[model samples]
Target: TKMRSNGRIQLHSEDPHQLVFEALLNRGTPGVIAVDDFVLKDGRCDNETYGTCDFESDTCGWQLHNWERVTSQRISLPATDRSTRSPSGYFALAKAPGGRMVSPLKWYHAAKHRCLRFWFFISGTSSERLNVTSVVDEDQEKSLWYGAASEASIQQWFSASVNLPAQEKTPMVVFDAATSGNPGSAVAVDDISLGNTPCPPPGSCSFDEDTCNWYNAGDLTNAQWYRHRGATVSNLTGVQLDHTLGSKEGYYLLLDAEDTSARSLGSMQSEALTLGPAVCFRLYYVMRQNSGASLSVGFLDEHHYLDGRATTVKATTPSQWTLLQVERTELPPMFTIIITGRTEQGSSDIAIDDIDVRSGRCTTAETDPEASMPPTTEADSPATSHVTEPMPSKQPAPPEVVTWQSKTTAAPATTEPLPPVVCKRGEFKCRTENTCIPGSLLCDGVYDCLDGLDEKCESGAQCKENEFFCVTRTPSACQPRSMLCDGQEDCVGGSDEALCGACPAYFC
Candidate 1:
């Protein structure tokens, strides 16, 4: 039977796989084979038909199973991949833990126009993953898509369309799904289709089959960018990696240097982009232990490094995700985003996410052009100051009678302005008040402020437990790391001498 464009037909068959094969392999009908809903059981069916969304057909080469029926009440599933098919029912993978299903592989001759489209719903946690792989040249396998389980409270079906490139040998596609042990982890798929058009770009990613956009480029041994579900440090302390909690905004990129002993550099670069004039670039970033660390981004011109400008920001612990925006007026033919992390001996992890680069002019106004003027000459002015002669006062003016204003009629009451709270050279302002406290006293387990704002600190610093911090002075110094442990009274309060034994054995 030949399928017409934008046509709908319902075939009655106990074996759904047989119908699919008849539609795909039927002679004289070189058209697309589309499946609206899982042919097995609809979502409205009773629980008795819950695990029966699969069937076998003698006409088809292989078995067709793996997906099962699920009710729409559990999830707000999409009824269609495109508007062409809708009002469909729900279907999901076998909920059994570690259970998986694979679709029958069919061979297709090499063709430039090959694409696959489908709608899928994922729930539970990050443990649940769905992957689509294809094989060409008999043994070579290529992954098309990989998605972890969703943590979102409300599960929504997402549509995906991918391109299938021609190969030297025929290609076959397979759909794979795995359960993460959660009964609520609903993994539903519907509206399978094949087409000739190319797939859309996966957000900032180059292709739907590739990994994320940001990647490590510098010395991987010293430090590297890591993908994390949340902002967290590694488990092993001896390795000296400090993990943070999640970015609170889903997936994030992290640059860690806890393991590196000496000065190291970690560079995470973004995909190459051709930027337009006056684009606003924004991203959210977090800095754990900022000491001796910095993050920067720059644009490279055609001459590699010539005519490029970079902006760098020092690390600071923000209470939550912090926004950083950069506006560039000059447009480059092409540019690569380079985010480099520099570490001096020791540093904490740095994380960034929610990167957005779009077309738009900056909000700031353009500067006025310089005014044109002639050069001034010394002849324009006299050597001595010019004075005007005061008119001779006729006799002494009559004694002026001063009128005294009444207190009630005094000018509006004005209070004296409070003095600005100036902090010491090495300290920061406390959230509680304008009070300045030593940076060392901050997060030192001691409540330096009445409100204890100074003590509110984020975990994971490079300092040792026994080390003494003298943050009140210029160039904040740490005991034992300074002149204190060498039998010299370097600190005015002798804190360096007092904490001499606290210094590490190697330092002595």
Candidate 2:
């Protein structure tokens, strides 16, 4: 008997002869092959039926090599499954000494593409990495995504979305976790699903995937904005987690005042954006009490010049994230958003996240009416300043202002003549006082000058042969050449420790 393309069995006989066939029946079949009575439509498998997995009760048909179903109590890390967000929830976990976990092969077809969405938790050193890949063929695999947890993300779960392009053949999805053999390190994933829908559109940014076209204005000030995850390096200053994810695993734009001089300003400029008749800009910010930090949002023209007045806000609630919305009308065709942060030698840091821009006036439900900007004629308070221009025939609400105290005061007049001091080639003159100090004392991480002038090294400033100049940092910085590659970041920009040779595995 031969099988035909139509799946029918036909008997072929070259010599025609009388043939008698007897059917044999037995109470128990010795060997039998069973086939599922289902046909795949268009040779495509439903992702909801084949690709979705929660790992709550079991591995959900996924083959696990080194991974196992685990609960929060079983893991040393303080993380809950994304599915339930509860300690009792279960998730697939791969501990240090890891390998690959794979899903069953399936053929997927969609109008556009399939999106794989999952929540992952990684708690380990930099050497530990978790990668998601799809095996297209016997020897071909395409990487979907890969990431490693930082020191602050050990307790937080992060979400990931990957687009799976249409393939000619069925593919097996694989989760490969690698480690540096640290017994405490681990990688966890839960609540995975594949669907035909594309990933949601990201607005301006949540600061979770880089600054999103926003860049630090290098010439603004010595204080620089850093893209950071988890709590800042300083103590009792910045937020412990980002607002978007409410987890340390998320990213935010931070302006740390701890490492910068007093009254330092840090500015971030957005890419040029088109504006409609009316626009609303929104963002989330945190400024701790006594942070001495003030935030301002304003517009800039295409030429990078300020187009209008900036709306500044001060810290009100300590260590709490506040929502800020600014509504503008009669805006230029194209403009950029300028976010500036200023610190007055305070201990707290300023952070902002989840910036969004949209057309039309900010709705009342989305803004705090009580916190709206007051009229320009409102007298300035000691701890806050409310400034706005007179409205035209069409009232355009000014940006909401949360302001801080201005500690600056006019200097008293002095009649006495001061003596002038001249410094030698190897000496440095103080900017605020008539004093000179040796050039070697500059940027020593200490304030040797009365006004800290010796510590403020300008960009392109000449340094001694034995000094290492940190050219990347604003206002620059200098350190002893011997301190280069010492593993410690003495420069604000970490230029001192950059380009250092990699450390040995054991030492890392």
Candidate 3:
């Protein structure tokens, strides 16, 4: 039967090996005719119905019809003179623990397409920090999309259909370690395929799929498509890699459940930095839970970079998925973004995904044509400082007797302006007073954050004010890492000089 665009390749025969093309039902009454030489190409299936997807088809004149019959022998690959339709030719090339030779899980992307799909039989890995990744260009050095998993059980299989980029080449398949690394478990992949078909958007009147302008193609308008983590309070989805999990992508903050931090470079932002003009960006994220949410987003000027500009703050919108739309005017070209989320003080397991940056031009008012103007020369200076019609020399002697008019003006409240929390250095706002906390309150036996930000020490940097700073009190006890926890070694002689702050900044 011809494969229709929407219709799936259905296998509905009593013979198990019917889908095997050429097979010999040597042990059953309802047998199948075995065909000849055939070779399978890059294959896999991530379609949902297929359960776990993989390439299981054997391209030999001898096919499989559920151990039933052997018929015609004329459809296999150009094998050596020893072209035996034998399973012996098929051997497990690379075996990871718990790998199934039947259906090996493989991931791939199209060079220029829209969707990626596949199926695989997956076994649990022994290592928790294990994952299988889909790679493009084999930048083994670096890739963009990566993230964590949801389940732990193994053996049973599932299909996955990841959305592919509209502008990339056919990608290679990879088994990453985002989920638990079951060095002991085996994974099977099968039936690999890809295509760029028009996806009818929900409630749309447009039919033009060429540009994928399918109705809601309006950038970031669909709220349902967006995922959120009420607890993690993320603005965008983060790429999960290795085993360590939490709000990672374009977000950096401490997780309430654990003392470790996630220092995703994208989120390690600077407040007072400069950006070249024509600045803009868009970020996507998937939240794992529903809870309180508060994030931050802002640019930086050239004000403060004393220590560094590595600052991130909780920005707008919590408990909902969103594409943070950012724009800047007259910004330097190379500015950065720092987004942070701390769910109401004591929560973890937030999800994040898909972060992208785009730019556009500024209007004349925002960025005038004459970008630079020369300093005023002496020729442009006025002879007199005051504009009193040049009446400075002839000004009458106006002895002004200061008449004290004491209208009972209410004195402005003299309360000291609260210190800026400085979540994001020169860029983001100290909106939440005491958010970053002063070193004093953290360990100074004093309560600093009236809002209790002092107690909420992120990154476990709990060096309170007036505490034993490495400045004077050297370490008496010997700890491999810095016991001070100020991201610095406390040993006067640099004994505890190991990499102390190896902690990422996103996890609390």
Q: Across residues 105-222, which tens digit of lDDT does each residue of candidate 2 receive?
A: 5435534556666767776565566878879776898776666543222244555556566656668889888766565566888877775544322225665644544666532224
Off by over 4 Å in 1: 1-211, 234-249, 261-263, 317-319, 344-346, 362-508
What Cα-based lDDT does every candidate model obtain?
A: 0.42, 0.57, 0.27
Worst 10 residues of 1 by lDDT: 399-408
TM-scores, all models, native as reference: 0.31, 0.37, 0.24
Q: Which candidate is the best by lDDT?
A: 2
TM-score of model 2 vs. true structure? 0.37
Best by TM-score: 2
lDDT of each residue in 435-471, candidate 1, tens digit only: 6554445556777677886544333144467655543
Provide the lowest-lDDT 10-residue window in model 3: 215-224
- In order of TM-score, best first, we have 2, 1, 3
Lowest-scoring 10 consecutive residues by lDDT in candidate 2? 400-409
TM-score of 1: 0.31
